[model samples]
Target: MKLTRHMMPLLVMIALLCCSLNGFAAHGEKKPEKKAILLVAFGTSDPEARKVFDRIDEQTRKAFSDVEIRWAFTSKMIRAKLAREGKVLDSPETAMARLMSDGYTHVAVLSLLSSARDMETVAGTLMKNIPGRKPEDAVIFMGHGTGHHPADAIYLAMNQVFQEIDSRAFVRTVEGNLRELDISEIPFERPTRF
Candidate 1:
């Protein structure tokens, strides 16, 4: 089953709750639970993009000051690219293994990107709240797509959902099957004259 962005925090909370309860159930004195948060990203080789990641890391550290924070990059290509420049980043698996070896009882992994449903909600809300938007005005959302991955279908699905939410709203991708979507296919209606 696919895990949604909205579910990540809930799952983390539940894991923490379970860990606390389990500690209480122990026969002897309670043991302190070691918890950590692992932020995973697709990663980019661009030095400028590293600033954004730094900001996220800073904010996460501030928010969870007591909990240990770590990072992992999911893209092997990006990791290798960085490695060539004498910088190394751990893969998600490697990061998790290290945390386990360090005796972290609970590790929460968080990643960017929302699930299809969450994307739909965001699109719908945006379409509804546009300033001075007319019925004939069209709103298009552009996204990056994995050219050949099965996940590319998410772009098409989101496009369909956007159109359903507002016939004038549409979605397009930069590098996917729907990248060449014809404008004529979009259901754009002309405003009616009184």
Candidate 2:
């Protein structure tokens, strides 16, 4: 079956989880693996943004029918905001703790910000979805970067991939020292094109 952009990340995550479980099983432990999937995201306070998470949750549940699925938010601020509004969300640590306590031996934590391959799929999807996009029109994607983490390199790699795919495509970070394409250098005649 052909994977959609939204499902690509989930498939990659499932493959990784399967590999991990297989490796653990190879160790000769007799305990049955109680598998679970934890979907982690930076999260958002906006109701509209929350819809994306809901969709992901629904899709994950459908994909892993037998496995339990849960969610955690990485952003403390977002969590706090939601909590104040009477919606409780768990942190990654708390979620993992709960999973362990519930006897989930094999828990796969899937982050919303996926690897370069998944990001490439998302970028391509975004470009294709743009209404009446032109060959000369540029598409710039802004991503939230982990300041000091090694994962920050993914942004750089994605930027390079975006450039390689189409010189008009660009990626920038909201919080990182990573060098991005200079927006000032790109001449923008039609504001609508952006």
Candidate 3:
């Protein structure tokens, strides 16, 4: 019935603790879904190339308005060169690790590479290996292909490579399309294995 100054602080803290517990009980039953988009690129040291990268990044952010956007460069040499110029670049591995630590439940990666290179491999491996990364998650690589070059087949080959590993991963080109491959079926769910 009697309260002193020393007891007041203790009472207030106890009340706050009760409120916190109530808050947790009310909302902590279900975790909030955290989603992110990571745009991976080979990265360039040239200003013009950087401008193109920036434009692509901006467009991607616009398209994926809800999810948080991050960037990673797959080229170590380009990263080093940019670092010398006072620019920071996160590698694909680094970005994925950070996203996992940040509690993202779903991640969609869009890589701006012309062909299946080291970056594509890294993206595919990370998507497959990231703990708790689900079938709903997507990894897409965009390439610049030309009809005049035989190298355009690389994109189709990479797409097949992704399909074999996980259906959610896809590779496509701006100027190329494979008759056997359909872009409409991207972000596909994998068949359950018994």
- Candidate 1: worst 10 consecutive residues by lDDT? 185-194
Q: How do the residues 1-194 of candidate 1 rate in per-residue lDDT, one tens digit apiece?
A: 97544454465566555544655555886666798998987788887979979998999999999999998886678899999999898877677667765667788877654576667776777787878777877677776666756667777888878877876677777777777666676564685221
Question: In model 3, which regions exceed 4 Å deviation?
Answer: 1-29, 113-194
Residue-level lDDT for 190 in candidate 3: 50
CA shift at 132, candidate 2, in angstroms? 3.9
lDDT of 2 at 83: 99
Candidate 2 wrong stretches, greater than 4 Å: 1-32, 179-181, 184-193
lDDT of 2 by residue, 55-165 (tens): 989999999999999998877788999999999999776777677667677888887757777877866777778777787788777877767556677778877787777
- Kindly report which residue pairs in candidate 3 clash with one another: none
Output the lDDT of residue 13, model 2: 60
Local error of candidate 1 at residue 177 (angstroms): 4.5
Clashes of each: 0, 0, 0
RMSD of each: 7.7, 8.7, 20.1
Residue 133 of model 2: what lDDT? 79
lDDT of 1 at 41: 78
Cα lDDT listed for each candidate: 0.74, 0.75, 0.65
Better of 1 and 3 by TM-score: 1
* Best candidate according to lDDT: 2
Error of 2 at 139 (Å): 2.0
